[model samples]
Target: MKSRISRLASVMFIGAVLAGCSTFGNTFYTASYTSVSDAGYVIPAIPTEKIPPQYRRQIVNYATNEAPGTIIVDTKSKFLYFIMPGGKAMRYGIGVGREGFEWSGTARIAMKREWPTWTPPAAMIRRQPELAKYRNGMSPGLKNPLGARALYLFNKGGDTGYRIHGTPEWWSIGKAMSSGCIRMMNHDIIDLYERAEQGAKVIVQQ
Candidate 1:
């Protein structure tokens, strides 16, 4: 019985050590996916297991000619990459526009807002009359489509009417179900919001 107890303790110790190593080595995943309370709202933790590994946020070695701080949206892959210096990037999974709603272009982040109000565009309300009530704008809350943050995209012509914004629908990541705006998990968007600069260049690739 004593020998069995000793072996059990050894196994427990090894498991603890391995778990610690994983936490230390992957702090990005550990810290980014957890529940967060911000601006009087509590954002729930994401079910990491439900999300595929490829769609999770991570720093990767991305070879790109674009300068650091450029936001590149590869819609085909459902990945948004924020270029970093020395051939590296902070990549996050995203939900893109559906078939007929897809768009590709260069734009600048004209504005950033936290806990932003969501106003359904007139065209959107026309398609979904139920959204007519929100045409004036929906108050920011847990149920708001624009979750924790929003980065408004614009160009020389003016507002592109598109956004890189957080979504309450976390499961939508790595899919094409939006209406032209790029959607991200609330936690991931909060992280990106902190890093993204106003007026930064954004490239959307089909």
Candidate 2:
């Protein structure tokens, strides 16, 4: 198994070299959280260990011409791929806007906040009266909708009022379940928030 990881690491390194004209494909590597000792090509990240089983599948072949800082959100597949050097990428499972909340096209990471306070919009409040109490501002914490981090979205000249943020709900992955913002599992979001930079270009493809 160790030999396999080393081999994969080498292939990943090579992929970085032939990046411009690269081909990509994916394979499943799912195992329960408690089992990893026998896996042949595991990436050994914390998410693979703690994330729920259903959220572990990653898309390995999508190619992007976007630079290192670009974020491509595939709403239909519920996957978010972060471009890496050498024509490789680190993919994360995501929870996107529910039916009416879906959005697409290009945007940029306008601002980022750790433990962002959430304030429900007037529409949400009217739709769900229980949220009326948070019209002012909801403290950032485990209970808050934004979870641990937030990547605010903006177009060329202004905020879209939409964002890519974290959520405590891991099971929501692959489900259209946010108020338009792209949501990632808390564990997954923190990993992304740390690697992603402010002003990164984001493309939401439906």
Best model per lDDT: 1
Colliding residue pairs in candidate 1? none
lDDT of 1 by residue, 7-115 (tens): 9999999887555232325443322576888988899988878887777887778998998999999999999999999998988999999999999999999999999
lDDT of 2 at 107: 92
Candidate 1, superposed: residue stretches over 4 Å from native: 1-31
- State the TM-score for model 2: 0.74
> Superposing every Cα of model 2 onto the true structure, what RMSD results?
8.5
RMSD of each candidate relative to the true structure: 7.8, 8.5
lDDT of 2 by residue, 1-206 (tens): 99999999999987775552223234443222221221122222244445544355343555767898688888887888888777767688788888788789899887989888998888989999999989999997777888778999999779888878877676677788888988886656766888899889999999
